[model samples]
Target: MFDIKQYLQEQRQLVEEALRQYMLAAEGDFAAHIETMRYSLFVGGKRIRPILCLTAARCVSDEPDVDMLLLPAACALECIHTYSLIHDDLPAMDNDDLRRGQLTCHKKFGEAEAILAGDGLLTYAFELISSEQFLGLSLEVRLRLIAVLARAAGSLGMVGGQFLDIASEGKEIPFALLKTIHRSKTGALITAAVQMGAIGGGAVAAQLQALTEYGGAVGLAFQIVDDLLDVTSSSKQLGKTAGHDAGQGKATYPAFFGVEKTRALAIEAAERAVAALVGFDERANPLRALARYIVSRTN
Candidate 1:
């Protein structure tokens, strides 16, 4: 069996090093602004999105050195994800003080700087993908990755879902709308992470479709687990405020189906994600493990 914990540690270290190398310095004129951005990017988390991007690339590629080729795109995904988190924790959004066990960007650096930092990170993601300096990727692939990621992170996807979430808060939200919120707000980027990886690896149309299915299911499962953790885990364990969803009257799987049923639903989603990988061989084992890990995680 694959040792997921060890694999995660190795991949995390690899990605952290890549992030350090790729990260822009906080020097020159905009020092404070860059420093604010640096603070959030370095604050610790699992780095799941980038790892998924790399692993998905590995799954589709037979080459031993495929990770190196995909690292830039993976880092780009992390930038986008980190930016979303920064914006999500703002007072106008989720309105909490903690992320990755540290004060949120808005709380530590003030709202304006945090907003700018988030904007900087979000725009920088595209810069990373589109820049001529980012080598080893064809222009066509880079453009396609840029387009896909833009849609996932933009108005019709994560941003739109966030709009719906803020709009529906305190209202009696139905299950259908709740799924929409989860799929758009959280699921789209997750899917994009895998999709971007597949694109980076030069996957075929069928492999791309299969990974999309896996990404979508796993993304839903990840959100459901997040909702469960908010209710069941402590702030210390979660690295943020617990019960925040219910306190804010945010719709969640547990809110709709209760804890036990929500747990079952998460399991189902993970199963779907794993099932979607049946077309691949043992190269996909890491993804399978990751999908299963989504439900078991405490934070």
Candidate 2:
């Protein structure tokens, strides 16, 4: 049997080491600014996006150094994810004081500094992906990867979903709109991570399609589990403020379908994600385990 926990820990270590190597060092006149960015980047959290990126590459390729080849892009994905978390925890956004059991970036460093840090990380993500380190990839492949990241992180995806989430607060929204919000805000980048990895790994058209389907299902499952956790788990268990969704009157799976049904939906989505990889071989087992792991995770 595959040990999902072990897989995650090992993959996370690889990503963390790469992040430390590739991330900007805090130095010189801009030391404080860089420190704020590094603080959130280094602060603990599940490095799910980058893990997904690397795992997806493994699924599609047999190259001995595929993971190393994709490390820069995987680290870039983490940078984008970290930037989103920092901005999401801002006072103007979720207003949370804790993240990964530590003070939120804005709370520890100042609101303005946190905002700039997010911006810096966001921009740095592109820089890292586009740097000469990634030139090993074909120009066309590199461009596609960059485009995928941009579209997922831009106004049409994560940003747009965030806008809808904030706007829908304290208001009853249709189930469809709520899904749109979740898909864009959370699913877009998650799917993009998989897509980029598939592209980098040279997955053929059919494999890419399968991975895209898998990504969408896993992403949906991830958000559903997150919503359920907000209602059922304590802040200490979650490493962040729990029940904030209810406090802010945010639309969530628990609020819409209740905890039991939401939990079932999450499981169902995870199953769908696994089913999407039926055509793949043993190399895709990690992706399958990851989907199941996402729904079952408590924090």
Candidate 3:
């Protein structure tokens, strides 16, 4: 039997440790800003993205040392992700006061500093990717991974999603439109995470295709679950504000389909995501578990 919980626990610890290592300490005027940025970056979460990267790398390779090799790259993804959250929570954006069970970055550090901190994290992410440690991979592979990361984080991906999300605010957005928004916003980078791992681990052809499908399915499912949790869960339970989506007049699956249908959709998405990894060996089991956990999580 696959011990999904045990694997997740161990991986979570590894990701947390890696995040701590990635955080740079500031010693001067920007010390407080850096500290606030690090605070949100290290805030407790499941570390899902990095785990997905590590798990995907393991599935297609014979290398047990994949975790050590991919840790920095995985950590860079989190840095980019954290920076997005910090910017997303700004007064001009989601304008929330809480995140990951603590005050939002802008709330803890001034808005200007929070913005710069986010910028700092985003730029630092690419630096980490290009660092000497990750150079163990072929230059071609590293370049490909960097290109993928850049596109996933760029205007055509996450940023474009945010743009549409903001544009759709307070409007009656169609279900299809909402899906398009999420595919770019949440799905693109997630799929990239899986792809990056495969590239980093030297996965070729069919193995890479399977993992990409797996990532795409879960990426959408992740959003569906978030929509469900907004209605069914409490802020304290979620470790962040719940019901904010509806309160903010944002388009969501639940808002259009109702909670019952949305929950069903999440389950279906999760199952499909798991199905995509069927041909892979036991190394893919964690990816399967993560797909299930994404929808099942209360937060």
Candidate 4:
């Protein structure tokens, strides 16, 4: 049988090693700033975005060292993800005290330092994506990848969704609005991760289209699970403050559909995610399993 747990652990370790090698050191004249940036980036998490990016690249590419070729892009994704998490936990946002079972960046390093750290990571992501070291990948491909990531993580995507979320706080938002927020805030980056991998691996239009569909479904499902976890799990289990959705009066699947219906919706989304991979064979099995894994994850 295919062991998803083992596969996840192995991939996670690969991502961990790559991150350590690619990350900046906290040893320069700007040591404290770099340390603050490294603080949250090195903190324990599943490293799902980078892993998904690399796996998507492998699925599309026949190159033996696709992982090496795509390591920079994978690292970029992680940096962007880490930056979002750092800002999300700030007092102005979620106001959470913990993340990945450690103090939030703002709490650990103070607000100003944390803000700069987030800014540093966000800018560094694009820098890594366009670095001269990744010159082997054609200029066109790198530009495309950078453009895709920019649109996803920029004001028109993740940031826009966050703005809508904070604006709608303490008010009853319609289900459609909530979905818009989730799709932009959470789903966009996840889609970008897979799309970036596909672009790096030289995917054609059709293959990219299929993977985009798959990513969209999986990303939405991920947010649905997060909504469920906010109500059903504890901070100790999630490694961050839970129940924030309800406390903030934010709209969620559970808020509109109840837990059982929300669970059913999550399963449906996962099923759609797997169905989108119909064109691929066993090579895409990891993506298929990941769909189910998202709903079943504890945190």
What is the lDDT, from 0 to 100, of the residue 137 in candidate 2?
79
RMSD of each: 0.8, 0.7, 1.3, 0.9
lDDT of 4 at 261: 96
Best-to-worst ranking by lDDT: 2, 1, 4, 3
Give the alpha carbon lDDT tens digit for every residue of 1-299 in model 3. 77777888999899999888866776688787678768878877777888889889988889889878888889988988999889999999999998878888889878998899899999988888888766667788878888989999889999899989999999998878899899999998899899999988888889899889998999999999988888889999987888999898999988888988898999999899999988888878888888988888878
Per-residue lDDT of model 4, residues 126-209, tens digit only = 999888878768899999999999999998889999999999999988888999999999999999999998899888899899
lDDT of 2 by residue, 1-299 (tens): 99999999999999999999999899999999999999999988799999999899989998868888888999889889899999999988989999999999999999999999999999999998889877667889888899999999999999999989999999999999999999999999999999999999999999999999999999999999999999999999999999999999899998889899999999999999999999999999999999999999999
**C-alpha RMSD of candidate 2:** 0.7
Off by over 4 Å in 3: 28-30
Candidate 1 residue-wise lDDT at 119: 98
Q: Looking at model 4, report the run of 10 residues with the lowest lDDT sum.
A: 129-138
Return the TM-score for each candidate structure.
Answer: 0.99, 0.99, 0.96, 0.98
Best by lDDT: 2
